[model samples]
Target: MSLEHSGGENADSDLYRIRHSLAHVMAQAVLDMRPGSTLGFGPPIADGFYYDFVLSEALNEDDFPEIERRMRRILKQGQRFYREELGADEALARIDEMGEPYKREYAQELLSREDLDGLSFYRNGSFLDMCEGPHVDTTRDIPRDAFKLRSVAGAYWRGDSDNVMMTRIYAWAFDTREALDAHVTAFELAQERDHKKLGRELDIFHLDELVGRGLPLWLPNGAVLREELEKLAKELEFRAGYERVATPHLARADLYRKSGHLPYYADDMFPMMELREAGDDGEAVKEAYVLRPMNCPHHHSIFAARPRSYRELPLRLAEYGHVYRFEESGAVSGLLRVRGMCMNDAHIYCTEEQIRSEFKGVMQMYAEAYAAFGLSDYRVRLSRWDPEDGKRREKYVDNPEAWEYCEGIVAEVLDDMEVDYVDGPGEAAFYGPKIDILCRTVTGREEQLGTVQLDFAQPGRLGLVYVGADGAEHTPYCIHRAPLSTHERMAAFLIEHFGGAFPTWLAPVQVRVITVSDQFDEYGHAVVDRLRRRFVRAEIAARSDTVSKKIREGTTRKIPNLLIIGEREQADGTVTLRRYGIRRQQTLPLDEFEAWIAEQIASRALP
Candidate 1:
C-alpha cells in the first residue's frame, strides 16, 4: 500500500513486476498498431494495467488482437530494456522527432516541476518509451501464460474534459493460468448476476432513453420489492419509537437557501422548475421549485414545525422520501446512481447528552437490520474534521473544542463496540462528520451500500432549538442514517450477492409445485393454495409440459422449493420436495412439508 510503503522494492512481487512490464509492452503494441499514436503514462493498477494513448484514429474492437500480437512479438524477441537519462530539451526533441506529441507535452509539463529529475527513457525491441522505470531488465521476464487484452475505453487526458480524450487499453495478467481461469469464470458469473441484465430478465425495472438516462421505471416486480422493504422499515421504525411523516418531492427555492444547499450542492440538483400565476393583467411571476436532493432538509422542517421542550429532545421523525439529483450523463449508471430514487431516511433530534445513546441505538438497529439479510463483514469510514488544518475554527462551528470533543466521543463509541473502522480526514459533510459503511461485491468491486451521517450544522442554520432543563435554548444533534439504503440499490446488491438464488423469504417466487401429469394439476393447485395461505410465495406450473421440462424451468427461475406430486403421492397424501441448488430430494407428508418450508422461510435459510 502507498500508505505503508513510500517506495517499493522491484523484486518484492513477481506479479507486479510482470504486470508493470506488460504496460510497457502494451504501449509499444499501440505505437506499432497506430503509427501516429502518442503515449501517455501506463502504470500497473490493482488488477492489471491500462495505458492511455492519443491516437490519430479511433481504434475499435477489431484492433485489440493485432495490438496483442505485436506485444507477443516483442516478448518473443527478448529485447533488453535499456534506460538512460536525458535533459529536458533533449527529451522533448527526441519525442517530438518521433511525432509523439503526448510524450512531448508530458515532458514539458514535468520540466516545469521543480522537484522532477531530468527524464528517463526505456527501449525494448524497436520501441522506446519515456517513463520512470523499476521494470524487469528484459522482455523475457514478461510472463506469457495468462495475460489478456481486456478492453478499450475512453479517458480524458489527465481526467480533464477540456483536454484531449485519449483511448485507454486495459489488460490483465495473473501469476498462473488456473488463477486467471478462476477470475474469468467469476467475471462470467458476475455478468449473469449483473442487476441490469437480471433486472430485465426477471422483469424488475427498465431505463428508457426517451424518459431520460438515469430515471428508472420500476416494473411490478420491482414495485413489489419496494413496498416489501417499506413495510419492513415502517414496522421496524414503529417499534423503535419513530413517527412517520410525509414530505414533498419539490420544495420552495427558499427552503434550500436556508438549508445551505443552493450554492454548494447546486451541481447535484436538478434544473429548477419555474411557476407563475396567470391573469388578464398578464403579470409575470417567477418563483423556483427544486426537486429535493436529500430528505434531511425536509425533516428539519418537521423538527422546527412545533415548539418543543427538553422531554421531547430525542425526537425521531422518519420518512420514505423520494429525491431527485441530476447526475452527469457520463456518470449515470444503474440503480447505484439514479436521477429519481427514494430513501429509508430518518433524522433524530437529541440533546448533547442524548447523542451517545442515540448513536448507539442506531448502531444496534443497523446490526439487527443487516442480520436479517445476512450481510456482514463491512468496513466503516468515519469522517472527521481535520484538526491539522488551523482553519478548522472558520470551517466548523465556533465551538472548536466541541468538535474535538465529539470526535473523541464517536471514537470511544466505535472502540466500545469493537467495530473495524478507519478515520478519514476532511471527508465529512460540510455540516459535520459522518460514517459510510463500505463493502466489496462478489466480483471484487467496492460499494458504498449504506451510510450514517452525523450533523451539527443544519439545525443551527435553520434556527431550530428546544427549551432545555435550564430554561435556555439549545440545538439538538442530528444523526441521519439508512440501513436498507434504497429499494433499487439494495435489490441490486442482494441480487448479485446471492447470485439470484435468493433465500425463501425474499424470493419473488419461492416455490413451484409441479406434478407428474395433467391429471394431477388439480392437486398441484391445491398444494400452491395451501402454501400461499401460510404467506409463502408459491406458484403452480400447469402448462402441458413434461415434468423434467417443468423442473428445468423452475430451477432456471431460481425457485427455492419444488414440490412434485404424482398419482401415488396424491393418493398417499404425500409430496416429493426438490430444493433448488441442492443434490437430493426428500419425501414428506403434506403437513410435515409445510412446517419445514415455513421454518426455512422464517429463518431466511441459505440453500
Candidate 2:
C-alpha cells in the first residue's frame, strides 16, 4: 500500500534527482531490448533500484555488457520526456504499439477500475513510461559513469506464488563514480568474508547432502568449536547465578496449548508426531509430540513444579536449548536461518522491584559475551507497544500497573547506568516489552542477534504463582532471554566475523606444527605431542609435501597459527610462529610458546 502520485506529492525527498532518473532510464533500456518483455513493477530501492520483468529468455553474466551499452546509447541522446494527457483508449493503444501484452492488460484493468476522465503518459523521445510524475526536466541528468548492472534473481509477482514468476534485475546507482567504485569494493570484501565459503575452505564445518538442508553436521574440528562455546556459556551462566537445566526436544501438544503457541505460531512449528498407547500403559492414552519450538514453556513448568516464596525471587534458570522450526525453503540460509538451532537461553522469575536490577544483570551478561567476541558496534533497543495502537490489550497480564511500573524500571536503569538505546514502537512481543540487541557484522549487515523479553501474562496463563511477603497469591513475571541467539546463526556469524581465523580458543586447530623438511620430523612430532599433553589443539600436516605447500594449505584454511621447525630450530629447541594472514614470524622459546598457547586456552578467547 502506497500513496498515489497524481503529479502532486512529496517527491522532493532529500536525494539527488539524478539517481532517480537513471532508474527510469534503466527500465527503458530493458524494454528496448525485448519490447515484448512483460513488466510487473519496478521501484527505487535502497541506494539504487530494481525492476521485475517476465522475460521470454533467461540471461547470464555475458548479457550485462550489451545491456549496459544499450543503456548508455539511450542516455547520450538526452531524450525529452513529453507528458501526454491521453484518453483511456489512447493509453491502451499506445501500450499495444509496444507489443507489451502485460502493460496493455494493466492499463485496461486500471481503466476498468478508476474514474479515468484522463490518463497521462511520459514519452521520452520514443520511450514512454506509465509513471506517476516527479522526474528530472530531461534525461540528461543521469550520470553515465555512476551505475552498474548488478545481479539477477527470480522473484514471484507481488511476492505471491499464485502469480507468474519474474526475473528481477538489481542495479546500483550513485551520484559520483567514487561512490559507485566504493560500493563495488565493499562487495568484493564481503565476498571474501562469506562464512559459507570460509567454512568449506577452513574445514571448520560442512553440510552433507545426506544429512539434509538446515541441519548442519559438525565435523571433528567443528565439534571442538561447539564444545568451546558451550563451555564458555556454562561458565558464564554459573557465575551469573544461573542453574543449568535440560529440556526434552519433544513435548505433548497440551504443553504448547497452555503456552498459546499452537494457535498463534503453528505454521512455524514442525509437523506433529502422533502416538498410540501401549495396552499396558496407563489410561490408554492417545498422544502427540510436537518438536519444541521454544524452551520458555518448559521453564514455566519447572516454576510451576514447585511451590515457592518471594525469597527465591529472580530465580535464574538457564539452558542451551535446542529448538526446531519449519522454515520455508526460500527462507533457509547457510547458518543465519536454519531449521534447527541452539540458543544460549535463560529465564528469570522476578518481582516488580527486581526488574531494574535483573535487566542490568542481563545487560552485563550481554556486554561480557560481546567483549569476549571482540564485537564493538552494538546497541540496545527498547521495544515497546505501538503508542498509536492505544495501550495494547492483548496477552499482557491483567496487571496494568506491573507493565507500566516495569517499563519505568527499565527506563530508569538505562538512564542510571548510561546504557545507549533507542526506543522502538510496535516491536514488543504480545506478552511484554523487550530489550533487543542489534549487532552489526564486519560486512555491514545489521542483525537483531538476541533479545531479553519481559513476560507477565504467559506465566499467569499457566497458573504460576509465588507467595508474596503479604502471604497471599501473586503471579511472577518471567524474563525470557537468548544472549548469544542460536548457535547456528552465531557460529555462522563468527565464522565470517573473524574471517575464519578464530581466536586461539575456538580455532578448531589452534596451532599447526609443520616440519621445514623431513629431517625435522622428529622435533615436529615431539612438539605436537607435548602441546597435545598440555591440552592445546595442535595437528601435524599429514601430507608428504614441501613445508611451503603445507603452509599455503594452512593459509587457505585460515588456520590461526603455524609452528615451523627447521633443522636449526629443532637443535635450538625454538619454533617460528606464523600468524594467519600475516607473514611476520616471531621466534619464541618452546616453554614461552606453550605458556602463551595455554594462557589463550585458559582465557577462553572468542569461539
Candidate 3:
C-alpha cells in the first residue's frame, strides 16, 4: 500500500511515524490559525514534512514561533486521534458542510470513481479531517521540542501551473531532537560549500540575468576545469577505441519526430524554429528546426550517414557536445539544472554479438573515471521495463519480446562482471533499459553521476544498418554511455565534493607565491616564472601586504599549494611550502617542489 493509505501504522520505522504524525499535527495548527484554510497533500519527505494549503492570508516563516506555541498547547491537552469509516457520498457531504471546498471536490472525484471502497476520517478534539489513520494514541506522544517549521513556498495545486496557486509550508521532524539539530548543521555546511557561491569567489563561473537564466558563462578558471575534465574523458575514450565526433546544436524537427522524441519530449525541448523555402514545384515549403535536446538521434544519423560492414561493427562515436532544454524556472538550481549543458556523451553501434563486450568496456570506463575522481561509494541501478505498469508500458516501445531480450542481455553482462547492482522496474528509458550510477554527494544529495543505456529501438527506427558476414542487412544495437556526466553537473559536484579545495591536478590555481617583503619581490617573481614555465598554474603576490595576509588570501581562495619566498628561502634556493587545509608547512628545494607538482599533474593524483 502507498504511504498515503498506510497511515503511519505500518511505517518502516519510528522516524517515519514521527514525521507523518507531525504533518497531521502541523496541519491542525495551521487550521486553527486560519479557520477556513483549505489543506492539500501533507506528506513526509526525506528529511522533513510539508503541508500545502490555500489560506486567505499569506503565511511567513517568522510566524512559526506562535504556531509552535499553539501546537505545544494541543500537545499539552493530550488529544487522542480517533478514526471512523464513512461512505464516499457521506464523506463528500461532511466535507462540504465543513467549508473545505478543495477537500469536498476531492471527495466528489473519488465518489465518481467506482474502484474505491470506503473513506476514513480521523478526529482529534474538535478538529476532524478526512485521513487514513494509524496516528498516535494521543497528541502527547509528539515531541514538541523536536520539530520546527522551516520555510514557505508557492506551489500550484496538483503541480500544474493552470491550477490554483497555494502555499506549501515545509517543516522538519525527527525521532530525536539531536537528529534534527544534526541535519541543520549539515545543511549549513552544504550552504557554505554551495557551488553558486564558490563559483564566484573562485572566479569559476557566473550566471547573469542579462545573459538569461540557466545559462552560465564559464570564466577562465571554470574553462580550465572544463578543459581538464574533457581532456581526461578524451584520453579515456580514445583508449577505449572511441572516435571523437562533433554535432550541431540544432537539427531539423523531422529528425526528432522520426525518433519519437517529439511526442514524449516536446515540452522539455526548446521551441522549434520554422523556415520557409522554395520546393521543386516553385512553391514555398516550411521546415522546422529545433535546438537539440539530446545527442543520440544525431549520432544515429551519423551511423546511417553511410553504409557500414560488420568489420567496423563497433563504431563508437564520442563528443562533448552542447544541448539545450527548457527547464522550468522554479526547477532550475545553479549548474545542476540548466538549459544549456555539455554532455560527455558517446554512442556505440555494434552487432548483437558485440553488445555484451561493448557494455563491459563502458562499465570499465565508468569505473576508471570514478576511481580517478576518488568516488568509491556508488551503486549501479539496472533500470528495467515493467510490462505490468500501464504508464511505463505505453511510454516504452511496444515490443515486449525485445524488452525481455535486452534486459536479459544486460543482466547477464552485469553478472559476468560480478558487480553488485539493484533492479529498479519502470525506470527504463522509453526506448530501452539502462543502468544508472547513483551516489550521494558530500552534501547528502543523491546524484546520477553516469548512465549506460541499451537501445534496440532507436537504431532501427532511424534506419541505421550494417551488412552482416552472411551478406544480410541487420540493425545494430546501440549502447549510449556517459561516464563523466556533463561538464556543468560534474563541476558542481566536484566543487562541493572537494569543498572547493581541489587537488593540485584539478585545482584552477595550483600555486600562489607570497613574498615576505619587498626585498623578496624578485625571488617571488622568479619562483612564479619557474612554475609557470613548467606549465603549472602559479601566481605571485608581491603586493604591499603582510605575509600572513597574503597567505590567508591564498588559503581562502583554496589554492592547493602556497610558496613563501623570503630572504632565507631565496638565499638557500629553497621554497617554504604551505598546503591548503593543512596546519604544517615544510621547506623543499626549488627543483624538488617542481618535480613533485609535475608528477601530480601527470598522474592526476588526488590530494
Name the candidate that leads on lDDT. 3
Residue 569's lDDT within candidate 1 is 81
Better of 1 and 3 by lDDT: 3
The C-alpha stretches of model 2 lying farther than 4 A from their native spots are 1-15, 33-43, 52-66, 81-123, 126-137, 154-167, 176-178, 277-285, 386-416, 440-445, 604-607
lDDT of candidate 2 over 83-122, digit per residue (tens): 7777877777877776766666666767787877556666
The lDDT of each candidate is 0.80, 0.78, 0.86
Candidate 1 Cα misplacement greater than 4 A, ranges: 1-11, 85-121, 160-164, 278-283, 384-409, 423-426, 441-444
lDDT by residue for model 1 (1-607), tens: 0112211424347777677778888888777777877877687776677888888788877887888888888888898889878887787788877777777777777789655657888887777888766678888887676688888899988767888888998877776777777877777877888877777877778999999878889887677677767876887789889999998999998899989888777888998787887868895566888999998889999888898899997999999889988988877778777888898899999988888887777777878777777788677888787756674444555556666777777777788888789988866666777777777766567777667767877898899999998999998888888877877678778777776777777778878889899899888889889999998878889888999999999988787888899998899888898988886998899999989989986665666
Candidate 2 clashes between residue pairs 3 or more apart in a chain or in different chains:
none
Q: After superposition, how far is residue 362 of candidate 2 from its true place, in Å?
A: 1.1
**Residues 335-391 of candidate 3: C-alpha lDDT, one tens digit per residue:** 888999999999999999999999999999988987888978788999998889864
Cα displacement (angstroms), candidate 2, residue 535, comes to 1.7
Q: Which residue pairs show backbone clashes in model 1?
A: none
Question: Which is the better candidate, 1 or 2, if ranked by TM-score?
Answer: 1
